[model samples]
Each structure stands twice: as structure tokens, then as C-alpha cells.
Target: MKTLPAQLTPFVRSDVTGALLAETLGRPEEEFSLAELGRRIGAGGGVVHKEVGRLLESGVLVDRQSGRNRLVRANQGHPLYSLMRELIQATYGPVPVLRDLLGGLDGVERAYIYGSWAARRHGEPGEYPNDVDVLVVGDPPRRELADLAVRAGEQVGLDVNITRVGRDEWDAASPSPFIATVRSRPLVEVLTEASDG
Candidate 1:
């Protein structure tokens, strides 16, 4: 793994660390195995293992060996657990929160975060995004989506705007200039066929 510069002291640490913490702390009651964390975070097992070690040492996470598998979960008893959870959730919560929300809606075939936030996530150096822009492809109810966006925004501590479009309108062959422009830039997938439906 590449080392971060000595002067940098990000509260969330590496992307792998932030993502792993989000998954565990998002659902504090749920326990996850190391391999499962790696799979869920789309990171290498060794990378996940190293982050887990750091968390364990810091008392931010707790672990136990369940027969052959080692399981880890949030250490809710830690002094800084609540504070850290809030910070991590607000920063790294979009993907998991959006995925969980969109997963409940039957008509949401796909969902993505585009614009500035996506650009930054894609490694473009720039200012932090002021709002999160989401594009949903399918027929999910607009009113429900609006309400969901509000809830997601509250959790993320950033404004979340949703733009819903039918599957046809979102297709590459479609003539929508908006879709065309979005396709030309970075898009972070929030929901897709690969994840659980």
C-alpha cells in the first residue's frame, strides 16, 4: 500500500479506512468478517486487514474469532465512537446511505452521484462539493425520492438533490443533452445490478 505524506492527518484516514468504518458503524449492531469487509468495500483483503488492525489498536473497532472466521464490529463503548461515527457518516455516508435508500425502492433500476462530488471522488483536485447531485434511472416516485433526499442530506450534512429520469432517457442512445453531459464526466455508482437487489 502507498504511504500517505507525513504532514497529512485526515480524520477519516485512507479511503479504505473511511469506507470500512462507514459499513461497520452505519449499522452498529451488525458484525462483519474481515473478508466480508474487503468484499463490501471493494478493497484488497490485505488492505482491509491492515485498516482493521489500526482500528482495533485505536479501540474504534472490536474483533473476535468465531471459529475459523474473525469478525469485527463497531466499538460503541469507545469514548469517541459517537463523534467519529457522525464525522465518518457525514463524509463517507453517501454511497452506503444512497444504496440502502435506493435499494428499498422497487423502480430504481440504477442510481449515480454526478457533478462536483463525483469529480472529487474520481480524484480531480478541487474544492469540496457544496451539494450532492444524484441521478436515478427508473420510475421511482418523485415525492418519495424527494423525501429520501432530505433524509439523506440530514445524515450527510450536505444538500442532496435528486434528478429522476426514465431508463430510456438515461440510455446512451438518448438525445438528452443533460445525460450526454453527465456521461462525459465522472459518475459514482450508488446502485447497480452487481449489488443485492
Candidate 2:
């Protein structure tokens, strides 16, 4: 198992989050069963079901039931989804531009393209992503990363936001049923490699 850094000890465990997302990605058409979701995340089926219910209430996810089974899906049409895209596209898009430029010190580990892009890429294509919402793990230099993002915004119209938080922070927040649901799905559409030094 890969270990998150000490500073990121405050974030939620990406394992469960990633597992749930991977399962969702695998099943493009089927609504995930509580048992299936639990099996994927290595937790009790009941626990997964409860979490899914919580997600539904948070407006981060939506679900429909078929008999005893419940199908859950991310609510991409939500306003925040558009807001996230705008922020990213308005910030970064150019290939050789400043904001389009990623520096070495940005503490970006693995990045996942979640939200609208992911929904469109996996399910049905809707509006093109305005900005890209990337879930960045690891702590890169904040100022440099912000500078690059700002420059990219100025050059290209891509609103690219580097949502880089520590693992510990993630862990701390996930305990909340609301946050856990919000993060129930993927973060962006394209999982790109950070720029080379």
C-alpha cells in the first residue's frame, strides 16, 4: 500500500475514496449496490449504504432504487460543478503559457480529473469542461503553484485549480458524512502528469 506523507496525515484516506471511484468508473451503466460499493471499499455493505444515503442528501450524489437495490450517481448538473470548471478553464489552458506551466515544486502527486469532465467522459457528454478540477496530493510550494495557475488563467481561458490538500486533511474531512459524499465521485476528467523539472 502506498503511504501518504506525514503532513497529509490530516486528509481522508484516498484508498476508500479511490476504490469507490474506481468501482463507479468500472460500472458505466449500472447503479452500484450497497454490497458492491462496500465490497469495493472493503467495508460493511450497510456502512456503504448509509454513506450513499448521506451523499444523496448533500446534493453531491443522486440515487434511484430498483426493488432492494439502489443506484447512485454524481450530480454533475449542480452549480458548483460549473463553478469548478470555470475556475480551471479561466486559469489554465495554454500549452506553453505561464498558468499552463506546471512547476516542479507544486507538491502535486497523482491528479484525477473528476466532476463534469469525468461524468461526460464516463457517462454522457454534456457541456465541455470550462476549467479542470484536479485533486492534487502532496504539498508543492503554494506561491509558485498559485503563480503558475494565475499565469495560465491570464494566458489561456482554462480555469485550472490545483485542489492540493494533505492526506490528513482529507481523512479529517471524510469522517463527515457530507464531505465523504461530496468526494464520493472522481475529481476531474483528464488525469495528466505534472510538468517535468
Candidate 3:
């Protein structure tokens, strides 16, 4: 076994992280030896070896090996992967329908899943969302916002109620009563914020 590097914090590259994650998601949770993972991603064998070593050291993966072949999985109990899975399941599920609806909205910043769906997915809520509550920020025309919500609702089979607020509203100590209503829902998403503008 190679001795682990003493100082690899700043050296850990995001591109490598992305490549690993992409490769993991590309397959259906099939375990791969380090070398096999490297081949799949077009990375050199040594590089894959090092990356796998780092991931194993971080407790982000668990593995069993036969000879040189190793099988690895994202640690189910690992906090990061758990959270990532939850967010991915929620966002990629019904959220895309809503995201498509916001396509033409100018000044739209970003969308956040903040309410019941998020709460439930993140384990903040005891129950899952029955409907979707979304917060829209930006300068989208009112009609466009309404239309988006309607389309999202129809497509995703959820009651997609969208609340529009400006970036300034979020910065205030307290948002308006209207925003408060959306926030109070079992599930809510702050679909846009100032930084997204």
C-alpha cells in the first residue's frame, strides 16, 4: 500500500471529484475496481488509484477487493452522499417540470427547494410533501409566472403554487406576509434569489 500524502486538502481537485461522481452515476451502482473505474473514465490507472485511495480514506466509499480488482460504493451512511441523494431525488423528480416552466423568465436568478419537499427530503419534516410550494424571484412578468406554475402543476401531477418575490424581499429581516404564506407550506422552494439575478 502507498503511504497517504500528508497534505492533500488543497490538492484534491473538483474535476476529479466530478469525474468520479459522473462515472458512479453513469452506471447502475455496479462496483468497480480502481483500475476499471480509471478505464471507464479515461483517466490513467495511477490517477484512479490515488483518487480511490483518497475517497476510501475520507470514508466516502467502502470496498472489497479480489487480487487487484476492487469493488466500491458510495458509503450509504456517509453524510455527503446521503444528502446528495436526497436532493437529487427531489430535484430531478418533479422539479424539472417546474424548471421547464421558468425557461423564458428574464431576471430569474435561481430556484431553491425550501419547503415540505425539501424538508422531507432533508429529514427536516416527518412527512413528505403532498404538493409543491415554490418561491420565484426575479423580474418575470406576472402572467409568465402564473403560466409556469400552471404548466408545472399539470405536468408534475402536483399542486404547484408559485409565489413571486423580489431579491430585496429576501434580504429584508422579514419577508412579506405573502412570502410568509409560501414559506409556511409543508414544502417550499425559494426558486430565485438575488445572486441568481
Candidate 4:
């Protein structure tokens, strides 16, 4: 089977590591309590506790006690911080970032990433993808989504393309040629109503 990006190998080897990297490294400026981190990553409290201890010992993360809770954050001062940040962004940033950016928009039912980046993630050999192509299935306000896409593109260092479609159009038995093409391509689903459930 095709594997995750090589740079993410270490983190993906375990769910805990992957969640920690995705939740903490992706936002180095933010600190998370164990409970909050566990909730965000869908991990059990015990697993997060053990993994956080290991990470703290390895200097990949730093923690400080606040009253009864321990708050943890990525160790920005660590020598490998920058490289880890870049790899985290390359491997796990796009989907979550786009999900957060677009998931709350009114009428958005689902979102997917298609084209080059999706192919690359599926282990297709090629040059690195430089842009993110997002397909939004819903009737969200076009201007607002476009504006959010611009901001997200800047944050992720990629040109973001947002394509909107209505629910009826997306569920049609006979889709348009453009929709057919998208359906035939490799897709990385970022958000869906079912996912939340």
C-alpha cells in the first residue's frame, strides 16, 4: 500500500504521535491541556498522557503546570522545530486548515481536496504540489468562501482554488462533465457531515 509522506513517517507510525504533531506542531503558538488535546485528536486520556510524557522527555514538546492542569505546546526553541514545523505543514496541515476555514460556512455539507496534492498524498511520484484545489459541496456564499480561500492560501503558502457546487448538482445521477472529471480523480476528503457524526 502507498504510505504517508516520508517526512511524516515518524509521526504517522503511531496515532498518538500523529495527533500530537498535528495538534501541537501545526500551531506552535498555542498551548493545549491534556484533556483538550485528547478531545481534539480523538485519543483517550491515558494514551495522550503517556505520549505527552514521552514527547516531553524527547524535547519535542514543552509543558507547564497551570493549577490542576498541565498545558503543553510545541517546543519552538528546539533545534529541530523549524524542520518539524515544515514537515508537519507539508504532511498534515492542508486538510485540517481547510476544514477549519470552510467547515462552518452556512450550507457547507462536504469538502474535498482534489488534483495534484491529492495525487501526491496517494503516493504518486511527481514534483511537489504548489497549490491546493478544494471542492466545496454546498451553497455557501461565494464571496465569503473566496475570501477565506485567499487567506488560507496565504497561510499554507499555496494558491487555493475553491469550487462551489449545490447539493442537488452534486447528487445528480448524471453530473456535468466537470463534475465527472472531479469524481474520477484522486480525492482527499477533508470534511463531511458524516465525519462529525
Q: Identify the candidate with maximal TM-score.
A: 1
lDDT of 4 at 77: 93
lDDT of 4 by residue, 1-197 (tens): 22244323343545356657767998889999999887665568888888889889989999999999999999999999998777766555777688778876777899889988877655566777778899999888999989989988876668889999988888889999988998888887778877644
Comparing 2 with 4 on lDDT, the higher-scoring candidate is 4
What TM-score does structure 3 among the candidates reach? 0.45
TM-score for each of the candidates: 0.88, 0.38, 0.45, 0.72
Clashes of each: 0, 38, 10, 0
How high is the CA lDDT of each candidate model?
0.83, 0.48, 0.56, 0.78
lDDT of 2 by residue, 1-197 (tens): 12221111122233333334344433335477777677434556665665566656767467787897777865666666454333322322222232124434455554455556444333333665576555554577777667766665554466756566665655583455533653786443222343232
Q: Model 4: runs farther than 4 Å from truth?
A: 1-20, 29-58, 62-72
Clashing residue pairs in candidate 1 are: none
- lDDT of each residue in 1-197, candidate 1, tens digit only: 22232111155567678778889989899999998888776788888888899999999899999999999999999998898888777766788899888899879999999998777666566777788999999999999999999999998889999999999888758658999999899887888767655
Off by over 4 Å in 3: 1-92, 177-197
Among all windows of ten consecutive residues in candidate 2, which has the lowest summed lDDT? 1-10
Q: Of the candidates numbered 2 and 4, which has the greater TM-score value?
A: 4
Error of 3 at 67 (Å): 28
Model with the higher TM-score, candidate 2 or 3: 3
lDDT of 3: 0.56
